[model samples]
Target: MQPDDLVLLTGRDHQRVTVAAQEVGLLPGTRARVEGRVLDVTDTDAVVGLADDLSTRYGGADVVISNAVARLLPEESQAERADEFIDVSNTATHTILRAFGPVLRPGGRLLVVASSLGTLGHLDPRLHHLFDGASLDQVEYAVESWRGAIHHRTAQEAGWPVWLNVPSKVAQVAAVRAVAAERRAHDLAASTLIASVCPGMVDTATSRPWFSDYSQAQTPAQAAEAVLDLVFTEHVDPALYGELVRFGKALDWHDGTPPGEQDTMVTP
Candidate 1:
C-alpha cells in the first residue's frame, strides 16, 4: 500500500485491531493512514453505517476482503447450531460483498475468504441440486438444506466443524460466483474482479480448537501474505476472477473423493 493510501479496518473489537494495526506498521501518518471502527459484519445496519462512514471519510474502499468466520467446537453446548454457522459463513460473506461491491472502483478486487472444504464434491451428488440455480434464493436454500441435514446431530456425531462449515462455505463460494457474474453483467463499466480464497489452516481462535495440530500451520502474517499476493500481484489470471484459490494455486472441484488426506487440505 502507498503512503497516501488509507486503511479502514472494522471489527467488533476496535482496540485490539488498533494495536494490531500499529504493530503491523500502519500508523496515522508514517506508513499509511489507518482508521478503525467497531462494526459487526452480520448486522446489516452496522455494515451500511460503516460503508456510509467510508463514503464520508474517504469515498469508498478499493478492495474489500470478506474474512469473517465463526467456528463451533465439538464440546460446546450448541455446537450443532448450523443456523448460526450459515449466518456467519454464508450470509455475512454475501452481505459484505453486496454492501461494498457497488462502491468498489473500476478494476477493483473483492475477495471472499472461503474454505477449501467448500466444494460440490464434498456434498453428496444428490444434494447438488440445491446449487444449480443462479439466484440468491437458491443459495439460501442450499445453506438451509445442508444445515437441516445436520441439525439433529451432535458436533461429534456430525463431524464437528466440517459438516456445517464445508456446506456454509460451499454456499459462500456459490455466492461469490454469483457476485462476480452480476458485476460482469451489470457493472460493465466498473469491471470489478471477485474471487474466493482458502487461507490454509492458521493457528487462530476460530481454527485452533477444531484443528489442534498447529505445528505446521501458517502464522497470521503468512496467511495475510497469501491474501496480499492476490491483491497486489500483477500477474493474476483473469480466469481466477471468479474461482477459489489456495497457497497461490487455483482449486478445481474434484469428483473422486472428499478432502482430508495427507496430501490434500480441506479446511481454510
Candidate 2:
C-alpha cells in the first residue's frame, strides 16, 4: 500500500531525523503522515491526554511506534539516574500502552523500541554494572505482561499483534548520540527503546546521523521500512510475543563469554 499510513511519533524533533525523513519522502502526505507527537511521553497526564486525543481524532491507528530512552550516566552516578531512567523509559512505556491500548484496532500492530542494552551486556561496561543484580527472565516476564495488557485492551479480537525492536549496543548508542547531539531529550528514552526492539537500525528521520558513521549503521528510512514490513507481512503469534528483534549486525565479543554462558551458581 502507498505510505498513507498514520504514524504517531512520540519524541522526534531533531533536525537530522526530520530532514532525513523529509529527504526520503516519509513525511506526512508522503510515504506516511505522522499524525501526532506525544511531546512528553514521560508524563502520565500528558501521555493519557495525547492518547485520548488520538483516539478521538483518528479513532485508532494501524501502527504505534515508541522511540524513547532514558538518560545515561557513569556508574557512580547510576543510583540517581536509575530511577529517572525507569520512570522515563520503562514506566513511561507502560503508561503509553495503558493509555492507547484500548483504542488500537484488532490486527493492528504495536512496536516497542528497546535497546540491545536490555539484552546483551558487555558492550557497555556501564550496562554490565547496571544489570548486575538484574534477571532477564523477570524483565521478559514484565514486558510480556505489559504487552498482553495493551494488546488485549486495544484489539477488537482477543489477539493483538505486538512486536519488539531490540537493536545491538553500537546501534543503540548511535541512536542516543544522534538525539543527544541535537539536544532532543523529549523522547530520548523512548527512542532508545524503539531502536532496541527492531531487528536492525532503521533509515528514518531518527537514524540518519548514525548512518553517517559509515563504519556501523543503517539508515533510519531503511529501519522505518523494515518496521512497516514487519507489521504488515509478519505473522505474529501472541504466544510467541516478547522476542527481541536486533538491528544491523550482532556484537562480537572476543574475550567475554557469550550470553547464557555465565554460571548461575552462587559462590560460597
Top lDDT model: 1
- TM-score of each candidate structure, all chains considered together: 0.82, 0.51
TM-score of 1: 0.82
lDDT per residue for candidate 1 within 1-268, as digits (tens), equals 6778877666778787777666656434457766676777779888777766666777777888888866576565443465676777787876777778767766677899888876667755555566644556677666665566566553334332345665677678778777777666444444556789988888787777666578889888899998888887654476677778887777774422443423223367
Model 2 TM-score, all chains together:
0.51
Model 2: per-residue Cα lDDT over 101-217, one tens digit each = 566555555566654433433222432332233233333343344344443454213221122211123223333222223322322322212222543544344344323444445
Can you give the lDDT of residue 12 in candidate 2? Answer: 42
Stretch of 10 with least lDDT, candidate 2 = 259-268
